[model samples]
Target: MYEFVTGPLAWIAFGIFIIGMTVKVISVIRLASKKDKVVFNHWSWGWSFRSVYRWLIPFGSRSMREKPVLTIVFFVFHVCLLAVPIFLLGHNILWDERWGITWWSFSETSADYLTLLLMAAAIVLILRRIVLPEVRIVTTAYDYLLLAIAVAPFVTGYFAYHQWFDYKTVLIIHILCGEIMLIAIPFTKLSHMILFFFTRAHIGSEMGERRGAKTW
Candidate 1:
C-alpha cells in the first residue's frame, strides 16, 4: 500500500493534474478566440499587466483596500497556501529524490506555523461564508466541500509530521489528500489559480482600452 501510493499513485495524480490543466488552458483559449474574438482585438498588454500586478499586491486595489481585514487574511492565506507546499523541507526532499529537483525550503518549524495559519485562515473563510448574510445567501455545500478538500492535505500533513497518530496511516492520508487537491484544481473553482489571470486581463483590457476607465 505504501509503495503503490508513493509510486504509481503519485505518477497518476501528477499526470492527471498536468494533462487536465493543459486541456483546460487550451479549451479556454479556443473558446475565447471563438466567442470573445472582439475582446482580443483590443487586448492591451499594458492594461492586463497593470491589472494583474495591482491585484497581486496586498491592498493594491480599491476593493482590497476597502476590506483591509479580509484582504490581509486572503493575502496571508494564499501566500501560505502556495509557500508551505512548495517550500516544505520534506516535500522538497521528495522532489529532489524523485525528479532530481530541489529548491530552498522552509525549516520544519516554519512549515508547521504556516500550516496552522493556513488552517486558521480556512476556518475564518468558512465562518465568513456562514455568518455573513450576503455571503451566506450565496454559499453552497459545494463551497464548503471545496474548502475542506483544499485544506485536507495540510491538516493531514501536520499530523503526519508530528506523528500524531499511526505515522504510516497519516502519511498515506496526507499523500492522498495532496493528490486529490492536484486532481481537483483544473476541474473545480480552484482553476481560479490559473484562470484568474486571464479573466482579470480581459476585464482590464475591456475597461481600460475600450472604456478608457481603470479596472483597478
Candidate 2:
C-alpha cells in the first residue's frame, strides 16, 4: 500500500495535473484568440507582464486599501499557501529521494509555523464567507467545499509530520488530499491559480489603453 501510494499514485497524480493544466491553458488561449486577436496584440506584452506584479500583490494597488485587514490576511495567506509545500523540508527531502533533485528548504520548525498560518488563513476566509452579509448571500456549499479542498492537504500533512495520528494513515490522507487538489485546480474555481495573472494582465492592458470608458 505504501509503495503504491508513494510511487505509482504520485506519478498518476502528476500526470493528471500536467494534462489538466495544459488543456485549461490551451482552452483559455483559444477562447481569447477567437474573441479578438486584435485586442491581444494592441497592448505591449512587456507592459502587461510588468503590470502582473501590481495586480497580484494587493499592497501594490491603492484599491486594496478599502479592506485593509482582509488584504493583509489574504496576502499573508497566499504567501504561506504557496510557500509551505514547496519549501517544507519533508517535501524537499522526498523530492531529492525520489528524483535526486536537491534544493534548500525551510527547516521543519519554520514549515510547522507556516502550515499553521495557512490553516488559519483558510479558516478566516471561510468565516468571512459565512459572517459577512454580502459574502454570505452568495455563498454556496461549493464555495465551502473549495476551501476544504485547499485546506485538507496541509491539515493532513501537519498531522503526518507531527505524528498526531497514526503516521501511515495521516500520511496517506495527506497524499490523497494533495493529489485531489492538483487534479481539481484546472477544473474548479481553483483554476484561478493559473488564470489569476492572465485575467489580471488582460484587465490591466484593457484599462491602461482606455479600451473601456472607465477603469474598474
Candidate 3:
C-alpha cells in the first residue's frame, strides 16, 4: 500500500495535474481569441501583465479596499493553501528522498498553525454560504463539495502527523485525499485555482486602464 500510494499514484496524480492545467490554459486562450478586441480596455494586450500585479495585492484597488473582510478572506485562504503544503517539512523531506530535489521548509509548528488558519478560513466561508441569504441562493452542492475536497488532504494529514487518530490508517487517507485533490483540480470547479489568474488579470487590466484607476 505504501509503495503503491507513494510511487504509482503519486506519478499518476502529477501527470493528471500537468495535463489538466495545460488543457485548461489552451481552452482559455482559445476563448480569448474569439473575444472582440473592442471589449477590452484601450491598453495593449500586455496590460494584464502590469495590472495583475497590482490587484494581486490585498485591497490594492479602490473597489476592493472598501471590502476589507472579503479581501482578507481571499488573501488569507490562498496564502495558507499554497504555503502550508509547499513548506511543510514532511513534504520537502519526501521530495528530497523520492526525487532528490530539496527546497526550504517551514518549521513543522508553523505549518501546523498555518494549516489551522486555513481550516478556519474554510469554515468561515462555509458558514457564510449557509448563513448569508444572497450567497446561499447561489450556492450549490458543488461549491461545498469543492471546499471539502480542498480541505480533506490537510484535514487527514494533520490528524495523521499528530497521531490524533489511527496513524497508519490516517496517513493512508491523507495520501489518498491529496492525490484526489490533484487529480480533480482541472475537472472540478477547483479549476479556479488556475482560472483565478486569467479572470482577475482581465478585470484588473480593464478597470485600471479604462477607468484611470490604480489597483495599487
For model 3, the stretches where C-alpha displacement exceeds 4 angstroms are 35-46, 208-216
Each candidate: RMSD = 0.8, 2.0, 2.2
Listed in order, each prediction's TM-score against the native is: 0.98, 0.93, 0.90
TM-score head-to-head 1 vs 3, winner: 1
Model 1 Cα lDDT, one tens digit per residue, 1-216:
878887899999999989999999999999989998998988999999999999999988999999998998999889998999999999989888888899999999989999999999998999999899999999999998899889999999999999998999999999999999999999899999999999999989999988888877
Q: lDDT tens string, model 3, 65-163?
A: 887886788788889988888888998998898999888999988888888888889888999899999989999999999899999998998898799
TM-score of 3: 0.90
The whole-model lDDT of each prediction reads 0.93, 0.82, 0.83
lDDT of 2 by residue, 1-216 (tens): 777777888888888888988898999889889986866865656556656777576767766777888888898788888888888888888878887886779988988998998888888898899899999999999999898988899999989988997999889889899988988888899989888877777767776654532222
Residue pairs clashing in model 2 are none
lDDT of 3: 0.83
TM-score comparison, 2 vs 3, better candidate: 2
Worst window of 10 by summed lDDT in candidate 2: 207-216
